[model samples]
Target: MVISFLSALLILAGLVFFLGAGVGILRFPDFFSRMHAAGKGDTLSTLLIIAGFALYQMRDLGDSEASVSAVLVALKMLVIIAFLYIASATSTSALAEAGWEDGNDPVIAPKHENRLAGPPESRTAAADLNRNSTHDSQP
Candidate 1:
C-alpha cells in the first residue's frame, strides 16, 4: 500500500514534467526558449519521478521476482538521462545555429556575442510563416 502510494506520487510528478514540457513548447516564444525549458524541466522532472519509484520499490529490491525488473528500470533511466542530456545540448546548439532567437523580439547578432542564428530578416520571415500556419490550424 505504501509502495503504491509512492508510485502514484512519483508518476504524478513525472506527469507534471510532461505537462511542463507541453506548456513550454506551446507558450515559449521561440524554438530556443522552448528547448531550454523542455531540456531542463523534463529531464529533472523525470529523474525525480523515477527516483521516487525506485525508492518505493526498495522493499522489493531483494525479491527474486522484482529485483531484475527494478535493476533494468534503473538502468534504463540512466541510459535515458545520458542520451537526453547529449541530445538536448546538441539540439539546442543546432537550433541556435539554425537561427532561433529567444523571445518574440528581433535580435541583432552583435559582434561581441557568439550568436549562431541568422539575420533578423530571415528569422522574422520564418516566424511569420509559423504564425500563419499556427493561426490557420486553430479551431
Candidate 2:
C-alpha cells in the first residue's frame, strides 16, 4: 500500500512538472529560455517517474519466478534514468550554445517605441544602423 501510494505521488509529480514545462515553453520569450524550461523540467520529471516505477516494480521482488525479470526491468529503468539525467542538460546546453553561435538574441523586454529609443547599447539590431552611420560619415 505504501509503495503504491508513493509511486502514485511520484507519477503525479512528474506529470505536474511536465505541465509546468509545457506552460513555460509556451510562455517563455526565446529559444534559450524555452530550452531551459524543457531541459530541467523534463529531466527531473523523467527521473522521478522512472524511479517511482522502479520502486513499484520492487513489489514483485519476492516472487521467485518473476524476481529476475523484475530486477532486470528495474535496472533497465535506472539505466534509462541515468542516461537521461546526463543527456538532458548537455543537450540543452548544446542547443543554447548553438543558438548563441548562430547569433540568436534573447528578448530582454517587450517591443515598444520607448524601448526602441532607450539606451543605445540595449537597442535592437535595427538601431545598429544609426550607430554605424556616424562611423561611415567620418570616412
lDDT of all the models against the reference? 0.69, 0.83
For every model in order, what is the number of clashing pairs?
1, 0
My TM-score estimates for the predictions, one after another, are: 0.53, 0.75
Misplaced by over 4 Å in model 1 are 49-59, 101-139
Best by lDDT: 2
In the order shown, what is each candidate's alpha-carbon RMSD? 11.8, 5.4
Which run of 10 residues does model 1 get worst, by summed lDDT?
A: 100-109
Summarize candidate 1's per-residue lDDT along 38-113 as a digit string, tens digits.
7777776767676676666564766697687877886776677677767867876776555533343333345643
Per-residue CA lDDT of candidate 2, range 35-112, in tens? 889888888888989988998988767769878888899999999999998898898889888887786766666653
List where candidate 2 sits over 4 angstroms from the true fold: 109-139
